[model samples]
Target: MPAEWEPHEGTWLSWPRREGISFPGRYDAVPALWRAMVTTLATGEHVYVNVGDEAQEAEVRAVLFGHEAVARTALDASAATSLATTVRGDRVSLHDRVSLHRIPTDEPWCRDHGPTFLVRDGELTLIDWRYNAWGGKYPPYDRDDAVPSRIAELLGVRAFHPGIVLEGGAIDVNGRGTVLTTESCLLNPNRNPSLGRAEIEAYLREYLNAPHVVWLGAGIAGDDTDGHVDDLTRFVAPRTVVTAVEADPADVNYGPLRENLHRLRAAHDQDGRSLEVVELPMPGAVEWEGQRLPASYANFYVGNEAVLVPTFAHDNDAVALDVLRRCFPGRRAVGIDATALVWGLGAFHCATQQQPLAVHT
Candidate 1:
């Protein structure tokens, strides 16, 4: 798989359905948050939005129009100055940078459900790993599970199906032949019971074109996906990984996080080179409706020239941005408030997937 930090022709997102498990009570407020991400991303690249049908697409156009109006009204003189060439009063016009698709999905977690685009030998192919709705936690997820192959059909891209189950969020890769994943998610019998450690590792390497696989212990708390690596550790550089560290020992996450950190420190790359591990401080516990939602700085999304970090109205938001900025010196690290988004058990990265720029011969 191509490194997420690499330039993208666009990003793909599945619009949240009212019937989906995410944002159960607050569907109205969720669209604006998505619009915020859409607007930011549309400023630079194409945004392919998945809708249920033409009717839903019509609804989406209206929503985008409302968002654009509100955004223009809220912009200050400086911000307004930056947006000089504004869209005229065309109904259902937000930014003309979207390619709407009628791809039906049960939920809006695109990173896990969508295709993992990989580039090899100057060709782009969609790696469609079997998605079992995070170990069948959410039933009737047949639509989401079928999304990868559907996307390949939509874009006319060749797709390679490995047959074994895998979710995009469960693995992190450095464009340079190395991958990081968690045993908690991959080894779970709910996902692939027949596959052992060596077997699963082989599939990952072959499918991702990755030569090395670094296995971590577990993921953070309350992540319903069993244990997605995106919520724990991420690859910032080829030999560098930025992982979350829990400071409070009394917290349940402390032990698992510390163990993962220790594992990462002792871990080496494919060439047996010592891996450089950077410890990122975790945010304080964020609970809502008597449940601890998975909130971590590690779930940030890497966009073209911008790293959108998930900020939880915490002081460490700045700290996380600083660390990521150093790691991605060429990209602008901006934080988006994910307090409400994580109630859905995901943030920016989970909601988006990159459509890599294809090399033209």
Candidate 2:
């Protein structure tokens, strides 16, 4: 698996459906966030969106291509900047950069169900990890599970079936040989009861080309996927990671996050070098109707020219952005208001999957 900061041919997004179970009530308000992502991502690389049908494709087009009108009405101030000025105040052409595929999905969490791309020996391949809808927390994921094969067919790339339950969001790689994941998510019997830790690690080694695996303890509170590492920690460099930390000792996330940080510091990369850990502040707590949503700055998606970060309306929004900017010094770190997006239980990283650029020999 290529690192997210690596060049990308495009980013994959499984367009959300109005009737989908992700956003129960805030479906209407979700398109604005999609527009923000499409426009900002289009500025750096092509965006391949998976739509169920023509109508869904057309709706996505309106929100992305009609930036002039939508920017004035639908987009707020921050999103307006994404649509109008991205690099050097230049307007991005979403019409040229965004392409809609007819591939359908059961839900919008592409990071979990979308294709995981691998570039090795100048060849790009796709991995079709069995998706049981996060341990069957959500059912009828047939469409989502088929996304990798469909995308492989579309891209004319070879698809490899790992024959195990693994979400793309369950692991993070440094484009080297090191992988980051949580034992809570990967070891849960709900996911792959038949496979043990060593067996799962072997799968990661064979498929992702990651020989070293760093296992974290657990995820934050209200994380429905047991404990996905993407919300808890992320690889910023080959030997460096930025983990989410909760300062309040009384908070439910404090202990778990602190433990993960300690593990990262003692962890080693593929070269047996000690890892450098950076602390990324959590956006306090974002709740909707007494339900705490999984909102973490670690969910930022790295683009070719920008990093789309999930920012709750908190004072730490600036702090997170600054931290990400420093981590990805060459890219613009743009924080989109995820107050409404996280109500669906995920943010940008959860909604996107990066397709790394392949260079043929």
Candidate 3:
């Protein structure tokens, strides 16, 4: 599978429905954030969205048109610098670098339910791991489970189904043969009680073609997906990774994050080289209605020319961006305000999937 940091042709997103189960009371604000994200992503690479039908596509186009106008208005010389961080540094025209596909979806967490793209010898393929709504926390995920097949049909590529439940958010990989994941999510009985760690690793090796699997411990507090590595750790390079570390000993995430750090420190890449691990700061707890949400700087999405980071309104937002900037020297790490977006328990990385740019002869 192509690493998240690799150049992409486009990013795939499932537009949220007004009646979807993802955002209960925050639905009204969700689409606006999506538009902002789309605007930023469209300038660098194509933004593929799944709209259910003609009306939904029209609604999405209207939103895109309005945002495009905002982007166009910012074409002034002084506005260029500011919009570079907010959306894009260039103008956004209607139907520009975006393709609307009519596909039904139940939720907007595309990373959890989207097709995991793979490439080999200038050809692209997809792997459709089973999706059970993060081990059945939410029911009636039929539409989500079928998304990979629908995407494969649209792309005209062969898709393989491993028949074991896994979410794209659960694993992060280097373009090489190293894959990072957590035991808490994959080994959860609700998803695949029948398989053991070795068995699951074997599947990951075979499907992702990444023989090196680095297993971390649990996830942060309030993460519905038991322990998604994206919320705890992610690969920043072929032999390097940045993991979330909580300083406060009394915090719930401290012990688990430290344990994962220890594991990463001792981990090695496919070539048997020790990994260079970087520690990223964790933001202060973000809660909504008395419930702590899964807010982490590690949940950053790498696009073609930019890395979209989920930044909470915290001091660490700047720190995370700076650290990621150093890790990804070639790509700019753009932070998005995820304070309101995380009300759905995910951030920018969770809402999108990348399609690698196909190599041409």
Candidate 4:
């Protein structure tokens, strides 16, 4: 398997359509978030967006055109700026390193459905894990399930089918030998009820080439997909993890999050070293129609030169940005107002996938 820390050739994103789960009457906001994220990523690396047709691609071009920001202004601006000029025609050019693809996909959460590329012994390979629309939360997911294979075909690479249901959001790799995940998401009866925790861990080790599997108990309240680890914790570096925490014991996530913290503290890495844990505050509960949304700051996506964090326009946005800035010293931490975006129950990381540069022998 390729090292998870390898530099990405570009990131993949699927344009949000009007008709999809979590996207009823909120298509504009969702695409706007996608535009912002793609623009921000263009500043640092390449971005490949999957558009359904020419019409959608034209609309996307117009949106990106309106967001172009000069390099100097971007540095001084505290608020997010769009790099509109970089996107033209069907291609959004960013310093010759960035490229955009108009591939067709049914849903927008490509990170969960896209191919997990790995490099082994100077050879590039792909891990095509089965994606069942978050444990069949949505059906007829034939399109989403085929995305990884399509990407692998485009890259002319070999893809290995793990045959088990898994989403990229459920696992975090340390680029060495450790992978972190939550039992609530992986072992949930909805996903793979037949497989035990140990069995699932065995699968991860065999496919991801992981030597150690650290399990967290559950996810926070209001997460629809049982407990995706991306929304609760992330590996900032090998042996270092940033996890969400609720200071108030009365908060709904207090117990579950604290339990995960305890496990992480007791867990050891491949080297048997205790994990370095950083606590990030969860965005205040955001409820829509009596339903709480999964609003978490730990769902931030790491780009080539920046980290795109989902901000809820809450009082904690600045604090979350600062925490991420500390975790990624040299990389800029830009916040995308995800208040409107989360209505669909996903954020930046959930919507984007990274393609590592092809390794050479």
lDDT of 4 by residue, 122-191 (tens): 5667899988888888887888888888777877888899788899888888888889999889998878
TM-score of structure candidate 2: 0.96
Candidate 3 regions off by >4 Å? 67-94
Q: Write one digit per residue (lDDT tens) for candidate 3, span 150-253.
A: 99999898899899999999999998998999889988999999999999999999999999889888999999999898888888888889999999999888
Q: Where's the lowest-lDDT run of ten residues in candidate 4?
A: 67-76
Best-first order by lDDT: 2, 3, 1, 4
Where in model 2 is the C-alpha error above 4 Å?
Answer: 67-79, 85-92
Decide which is better by lDDT, 3 or 4: 3
RMSD of each: 2.9, 2.1, 2.9, 3.2
Tell me the TM-score of each prediction against the true structure.
0.93, 0.96, 0.93, 0.91
Q: How many angstroms is residue 150 displaced in model 2 relative to the true structure, after the best TM-score fit?
A: 0.3
Clashing pairs in 2: none
Quote the positional error of residue 230 for candidate 3 in Å.
Answer: 0.7
Better of 1 and 2 by lDDT: 2
Output the worst ten-in-a-row residue range by lDDT, candidate 1: 72-81
lDDT of 2 by residue, 204-225 (tens): 9999889999999999998999
The deviation in Å at residue 131 for candidate 3 is: 1.0
**Candidate ranking (TM-score, best to worst):** 2, 3, 1, 4
**CA error at residue 348 for candidate 4, angstroms:** 0.9
Please give the range of 10 consecutive residues that has the lowest summed lDDT in model 3: 71-80
Clashing pairs in 1: none
